[model samples]
Target: MAAVSLTAVPARADGPRPAVLVLPGGGYGHQADHEAEPVAEWLASLGIHAYVLRYRVAPHRHPAPLEDAKMAMLQIRSESSGPAVDPTRVGVLGFSAGGHLAATLSTAVATGNAALDVQAAVPDLTVLCYPVVSCTEDVHQGSVDNLLGASPSDDLLREVSADLHVTAATPPAFVWHTADDAAVPVHHSLAYTGSLIRAGVPAELHVFPHGRHGLGLATGDPGPDQWTSLCAAWLTRRGWTQSSPSVM
Candidate 1:
């Protein structure tokens, strides 16, 4: 098992703050750097503590990444007693396959597996950016293969698919995707949002008409770039953001 790393960014305030665990997308093969630090810094600037998770990826499978995410959440929550983070307010922000991992952490079965520690694994909220949400037709084949192997059983496929796992227990989610995302189709977000809504879980989804997959911050692109502000507002509404106004 490869060692996982957690990079923490403290809030500017002196008091404990809400935290967001950032998971970068890499099609389940690797972690994307752009999604890690930049995102953490953004959250930190917003007066929210941020932690970037470097979880195990491909050459690893199902439970590995999920376990890593759980560990990251626990680490952040464990700091609740200190001036680091607020345990009850910890959330997750993930991109693409990392989004899948985030959603998995949000919806996967606990199974009383001590290693999983499901009770501590649930995040207060989730924000998924162009996430790979399904294992069936709308799935990103590369992400599916990397995370579940080339010929996964139907049960395995259904089990890992985030949309299929959504229930009333699933956390509220704020999702954004590009309508033109070729790598991972937009239906992933749409389906997951629909499931969340049907389950009576609050969900907000945004579908931009342009941009490719893995756009990261989407930098200067006018339309897709609005996600940051939109997400900040959503987080604020969910109490994941700190009491202060969100930073640009």
Candidate 2:
């Protein structure tokens, strides 16, 4: 058996499966149990390397959480002791406010020789699990206010709209949300997906009928439980998940 520390789990012994880092949502004020560990455990069982990021909360402010996300991705990408970690197959999975962070990482980053200590951290694919898609419209009030302090500037507003920052260089993404979710609204997922489509980037969206916010993968529930199967299918289609074992 191999060790998978709670902080970060590297690519496992079987092979260099697609590494997925999970960011749980706590609305930037708190980090929840359902948002982190469960997702990692499931991904690990599927042979994907899973890292659970316990990022700095609201008092930390913008670019802080974003940098933490970048650091995590970089650490995984730079690890070379075992199976080669495929930076191209790397995916960032976030839920709720963490979803917002994932969106920021996917949209706001650019590659260059000047890549900071973060090492040009950016996932090849992003998965937003019922994410907060916008900083201005369809926004989560507490998250935005906490991220910006008071009277956020127009610049700050644009900074948070990950969709607005999308470029042809942005990674492909997949999104899911329940239509009945009033907490974050389905529009967040819709708007982001719309932007991805308009930019000619590949995106897949699933809007479940029920299941409001924070319904982490569970049994006998009407929430994100059904998402894993669909996600596996999408990964297979994108050639991210393995059909048969092979080391790179």
Candidate 3:
């Protein structure tokens, strides 16, 4: 089973708070350290309960990581105590390969599994940072290889390619990437956002003029660091977080 660490805020007097499941990127080989706890704490600081999911990586293939993510979503929705999280307000935030996983969850349809509540596995909203959204063109080869093995079939690739799976039912998303990201490329984010627009799903996209791939919070750097503030405001507008006088 995957381990999930929680960073929860105190219960609000008004009602249950929104929560997010954070997934760190590592090309599906390992979870990135900077993207995990720090991101979770940031979400908590915004008055949202957050959980960092240490999902299974390489040596584990397709469905393993997805299954872990699904399980984590279910756990968050099922929690009745400890943290006052509203089950209906659950969302997901991921980076790189983790973003692929988050998008997968958002676009997934009912699996007809007897034990799993398919709807519960989907996020109410999604945030993808420097994500690997496609498995066909402009693909992150390492993430594709790690998640689906090196010789994944064309059909399997299409199945996991999130851009190809977007529907009107898919959750709204906020996506960001740098225009010059050599590793994953900005096309991944562009492709996904285009599909979202075509599907009539509310989507927001940001393409920074500069920055490399995997700039988790993009701290210190003046250019890409604005994504956090932008995302925070987006969350506030969506009612996921309280509107504050200033954003961190």
Candidate 4:
């Protein structure tokens, strides 16, 4: 399938590196500019090809963001970067609402069991920064309600909750959340990480104290600037940074 449309930061001709697919946070309303674009540009500067995904929201809910994310992955895989982007080295990075999408891609959307009329698209790994996981627990009420429609029931959330969907096949993931995130509670990442552990999936998680929610990928006040370095190192540890691209 062809991509609907995308904004890409091409790899430097000299040496392309692992690619990152970024999904911006908007509480299922709109794509945040700083979260999506600024982070992409920052990643590009670090020698990685960063793709900023402006996925659909609100009036287009549930499977819409999931479908758009899959489309983005499909587009990245379809390209032959010519010594650039080892397609398999591609990873998904999401924030807050976007983090839920990333977790969805890694667990639900990629699994081929989705009830949507969409392709099975999954990234090699997922990077979820301050993700919203369970609707029943640690719920980001606005995000969950917007994503599933106004009267979304508990069953609806049970069906879409990233934690509930994790399985042995779920892609490896790198997760982080601030203990002080009042917007989206820290339990979101904690619960999700617990599920990942129970499923025996390869995962790395970090819980930093004091950095509030929606920091994008930048440092807040002081400290935690090392988060990116920590993430980059985690990718390296998983051997995900050097994986060769493959046909979907």
Best by TM-score: 1
Best by lDDT: 3
Q: Residue 190 CA error for candidate 1 (Å)?
A: 0.4
lDDT of 3 by residue, 97-133 (tens): 9999998888883334545537789999999999998
* lDDT of candidate 1 over 3-83, digit per residue (tens): 788888777876667888999999989888999999889888888888889999889887778888988888788864444
- Once all C-alphas are superposed, what RMSD does model 1 give against the true structure? 2.9
| Poorest stretch of ten by lDDT in candidate 4 | 239-248
TM-score of 2: 0.88
**Global lDDT for candidate 2?**
0.77
TM-score for every candidate vs. truth? 0.93, 0.88, 0.92, 0.86
* Count of clashes in candidate 1: 0
Candidate 1 has which clashing residue pairs, if any? none
Per-residue lDDT of 39 in model 4: 83
Task: Tell me the number of clashing residue pairs for each predicted model.
Answer: 0, 0, 0, 2
* Candidate 4 global TM-score: 0.86
Ranking by TM-score: 1, 3, 2, 4
Please give the distance, in angstroms, between residue 4's alpha carbon in candidate 4 and its true position after superposition. 6.3
Per-residue lDDT for 110-191 in model 2, tens only?
Answer: 3232453242587888889889868888678988876667789887787778878777777788889998888898899998
